[model samples]
Target: MPPKPSKPMMCNRKALPVAAKLKLIRKLEKGTSVAKLCEEYGVAQYCVNATASKSGKGLPRKHMKTARETGLDAAVLKWYVQERSVGINVHGVEIMSAANRLVHM
Candidate 1:
């Protein structure tokens, strides 16, 4: 008997560029069918649907830091500047230890 056909391997698809996503959204708005767009663009139906739903918003921007994190960043920057001004060779490990101490105090 002939061997059974093997299933194809699946791989992750690359994310579409903002321009491509915008084009897809425009086409969708112009009454293009989802299935037709999928075939034309070589993308999954979900990609088209998501792009249409989001209306070109794409991914959200990075979230804002909390007050504590903002304060920590400022304190670290100040300490780093001061260390450099005083001619002290500061390493990443030392910076991390300083942050730990600041957090504990």
Candidate 2:
């Protein structure tokens, strides 16, 4: 019988350098979105925020608005509610029925 293979090792690395963290903070301050920052930095927002948070730092304040507050079209919302519903076989009919009701409302 072949010898058993050892389990792979797991390692968690430390966060980025202070300078890099500051640079990201500056970019965030300039109105960059957290999602965009995460994509550009090749790191998760949680990681970035965790590092920043450790330094008692915060992302820039921006006037944020939700879709509904920004005048989302009723028809568009209705369509979205319809199209974005769960598609499980068990819930297919229920989802469609709910969507239809919203569309008509």
Candidate 3:
């Protein structure tokens, strides 16, 4: 028997830009059917429907959080740069030690 075709994979977070997502959102808000959108955009119905439902919650695919998102990590990075600029003998151990201290406090 011939093999059945597999469904396309769900979009990865990076697959669609914010602008594209917003456009889809706008179309959904304007009463376009999710099935129509799914067919047009080649995306799953859930992607269009979820964005349609979360009009106020937040952007659906915010970039993943990173160290900068945590205030402590940003502060530590700034401190590391400043110390190096002053010719202080900063080492990896010292940086990690400081980070551990700040995290514990």
Give the best candidate by TM-score.
Answer: 1
**In candidate 1, residue 95 scores what lDDT?**
98
lDDT (C-alpha, whole model) for all candidates: 0.79, 0.65, 0.75
Q: Which pairs clash in model 1?
A: none
Per-residue error at 14 for model 3, in Å? 7.7
Q: Largest lDDT belongs to which candidate? A: 1
Stretches > 4 Å off in candidate 2 = 1-14, 59-105
Model 2 CA lDDT for position 17: 72
lDDT of 2 by residue, 12-49 (tens): 44467778888888887788888887766667767777
Q: What is the lDDT of residue 83 in candidate 2?
A: 61
In model 3, the runs with Cα more than 4 Å from the true position are 1-14, 57-105
lDDT of 3 by residue, 1-105 (tens): 999999767565425567888898888777887788787787776667666666753346556766743888887898899999999989899999989887887
TM-score of 3: 0.39
Q: Tell me the tens digit of each residue's lDDT in model 1 across 1-105.
A: 999998554234748889988788888778889999887777777777777767744344346767658788889889999999999999999999999888887
What lDDT would candidate 1 get against the real structure? 0.79
Error of 2 at 94 (Å): 61
Candidate 3: 10-residue stretch with minimal lDDT = 54-63
> Per-residue error at 102 for model 1, in Å?
1.1
